[model samples]
Target: MSDAWSHDEVIYPELGRILSESQGERNEEIAYALAICAGYAYAEVKGGADKVTLRKRLARVGLQDNTCKPIELSVDAMFIDSTAFVVRACEGKVAILCYRGTEIADLTDWLTDIDTEPETYSFPQAPDRRNWRVHSGFYRSTRATWDDVMAELASAGPEALYITGHSLGGAMAAMAGVMLRKDQDPRHRQVRDALKAVYTYGQPMIGNVEFARECQADPFLRDNVIRHVHRNDIVPHLPPVATGPFAHFGTEFRYLNDPPGLESPSGYWRRNASARQAGMIDFALTPWEFVARRIPMAGSLVARWRPIGAKIEAVADRVEKAADTLHVPFGRPPSFVCYSIEDHAPHHYIAKLATPGVLSEFERERTSVS
Candidate 1:
């Protein structure tokens, strides 16, 4: 088993399917369907994956993958697509549910609203953070697809559940982790009740301070939620900690080097090594630098509109400081700074988790529990 197995494979093999690239045809009936697995799946969705192909790749993993066919979640809501699959590997029955991330191509065409509007969400069953508010856009997108995924999982029999996603999809995966923990769906309450763990990559802050503390204290989340942030990728700091009160939720795993087993096939170690030798530009950027880089990414698409209090000056300081605080505690100095967008790519995560330092953290926890 190579180091790229980010999660403790003994406990979360299904998730391994999400991180590995497939190496063959979906119908090959032999080994991996492609060189890259879900990484290739990510490319299929600049619209969405061809259902036939996705199902085939999933089948190769010894599981059945199903979707809410017309999850047709309002395009207005970002929940572009959803899939539910059941793994009957040696680990017994484990179901995995995932959300497709923001279609960058989708966002490229539309203007984005960055305003922060704190709003309460109503759920029939009270969750740990009912007062919980979320990124309005993300929350809207989750509305339908969550129901669809939950409904499917509901019908699927009791099993340990593993929830995950990357990027915007990562944020939604976090929320589904929370929602599933609640008795929201009586039908699959057993499965939800058994949510084993939540693994999200490049996720953004989903709610305000109240929701953040709520999740921090929530028993289910305290032990299970793991957010992986690569050196300085920009999305994680978003919903701007300075703007209002939106805060990130979960325990963060930050890695400076690649995880032991999973080395980048292209030998990214050399690239990162070369970048670091030039003064290790991997550290966090200063307020001005952070904003300078961030602003350009938003480009002309993001409205300069701030909801009343989103003063550019005030928020800048808070976001910068918050980045330092959240990123500093877990790793050493070089791991702190984030220099490029490449840091946000799953390829990097796939590489980092393959290393022992970060990957071992997960292995240790699973070992302790088992």
Candidate 2:
């Protein structure tokens, strides 16, 4: 185990208190805490920590009274590879299931992510079981662990359940949420009712339009599945809708990096254009800045010559203004072409959510809703 995970300080202070206080309601605090859990799921897999150790880590973060032990499940079968962990919080009043994201070194994970082939999706309660289509890889992965996940949920018997994951895991989390909610088994009714929300970060589209419509038609699924897309994160744009029957459903909360604020879907393109323009300007200025720093006398000379400096600044400003006028229409170049993979890192989501500004906005919105 790494020192970070082993440290005594609470990784997520007041998470238990927040979960208990919320009483299964979806709130910013719960979402923030779950993001931490999702990130920890990655750590748990990477560090190869056993359940006892994982429980200790969870306890350190304030999930102190988990009578139901944490359970980690790993599945590696014909094109289906995934790792996930389930644990109870607030004395089993809340259950959290976190799926591990794709590891760069794992070929199987990459294959699973890129497998865009569509497959027939049929659940007992699905409105049009025969016509529903979903990503083949994600479907298989969710199916592989469905029985085990349901069994754990039954054992935990939580009043509210939160499902979360990052990257590829996020995709599976969405699928699992749908499966659980659509399950017709009377034995799993408690599991379905206990599902408070599905939270995902940097997730990709998991199903076709028909499947998406199914999610939209269902009141609970429509309102509770929340997707967080970090600024210019590339993963969420995978398996392009133009290339396949893939589509994304549920509410989305997009966080912008530049100026650092939440953005609506309608404003995504404008924000992307601005961010891209800023990046371009920065790239253009870097060479000059580097040369000025490298040539010590050059910087002094530029400073001494006010006209030359003023002229340079004026030209740069003009360029920036001209760039601002150039609009990059949504889906013109395609998001994957311009997005940054680094923005999709799990830590970014964790850090962004914990930021005071973002939390304040979330809190204000929550308060308004209440």
Candidate 3:
């Protein structure tokens, strides 16, 4: 088992079927494809893959030449880098924007993730933008590449646009959706009119209650934004609403549970409580684990020392087992067990989306609603 951060290959095994069925609409199959695109965006950003390499990778997954293009954008502040891929599918009528999540080694990304202070949303086209407050870090990240993303969308000229991303990228995607929908600029009207849906995985809350209310008030956003929270992913519960004005708006789909399906706010809260507990435990052990892994024989000495040594050894054993379960740190993986840090990994999302009957069930529900 290798670290997901180092895994660069992006292959959608069901791409051909997904592309054939989705046509030009939003569906589970399309969502799955976009998730793959999101993962590929990470590869593009981290590996610094060239256009030829990106095209070749997309071609391997059945995308035709010129159907998809990678866009890399960065800001001077904290050297914040943002990467997305624009895919013109369904004979160029449907466009998908896929944003890359945070890289593990990037200090700037972690800083962006932790900067939860709310700031007034600044968008000239939005009439009530002054009243809207959003996560400062995410807002800066989205604004950094806003011009370039809009330029790509304008150039694509698609009839419908779908947005998707994982983790921090998901935050950016949500912000982009709001900004694009609010933009009344005539030059961007085509792109704005084309905005259809945003699908995010393991995304954290992006705004205040007022901001959420605005998103809910807009029929387009209310009907189109879909959030996917896979099991015990810890990201979605971030920037704690209890402590701040942070909030989320969108239809939430909870995956990888028994009778996997959607979850209401109350149900989500119940699950969140459990995840919070696990997160606390993980947090407490993080420093010790870090020291143990670095210093020579530290783990063994800690386990064999004194009266409390037995308890420490037992806890260490559990951590080892959890790490083995996902070949990563227990604090990280998205899991059905406890809240895991690794659960936020894109590979977990990719695997769950590729699971049999998951997308089919989601597609059935979507079609019935339509």
> Which candidate gets the maximum TM-score versus the true structure?
2
Query: For each candidate, what TM-score against the reference?
Result: 0.59, 0.70, 0.67
Order the candidate numbers by TM-score, best to worst.
2, 3, 1
Off by over 4 Å in 3: 1-26, 45-57, 60-62, 122-130, 241-243, 258-338, 355-370
lDDT of each: 0.48, 0.66, 0.65
How many clashing residue pairs are found in candidate 3? 11
List CA RMSD, all candidates.
Answer: 12.4, 10.9, 12.1
Question: What's model 1's TM-score?
Answer: 0.59
Better of 1 and 3 by lDDT: 3
lDDT of 1 at 214: 72
Candidate with the larger TM-score of 1 and 3 = 3
Candidate 2: clashing residue pairs, number = 0
For candidate 3, write residues 1-370 as lDDT tens digits: 4333212333444454465444334465566656666666666434673455545545544455437666676654754667777877656776778777888877777888878677787556457646678888888888877888889889889777788899999998988998898887899999987777898888888887778867878776765777777754667767654447666776666664333365322122111211121234443444565466356787565334422532343365567667867888554332223233556777667656653323321121112221
lDDT tens string, model 1, 1-370? 2344334143233543432222211111111211112233354543555545545444433343333122444443442344322333223344555555655566521222243465476544445435667666556555656666666666665355566666766776787777766545457668766576676767777777667767777766765676666655666766543446577666665544333564432222221110111022322343334455557654222223212222432344455557767875322122233334455676655544442222321242322321
Per-residue lDDT of 208-261 in model 2, one digit per residue for the tens? 877887888887777788888886566776665444756678877777534435
In candidate 2, list every pair of residues with a backbone clash: none
Error of 2 at 211 (Å): 0.8
Q: Which stretches of candidate 2 lie over 4 Å from their true place?
A: 1-14, 20-26, 44-57, 67-77, 126-129, 258-337, 355-370
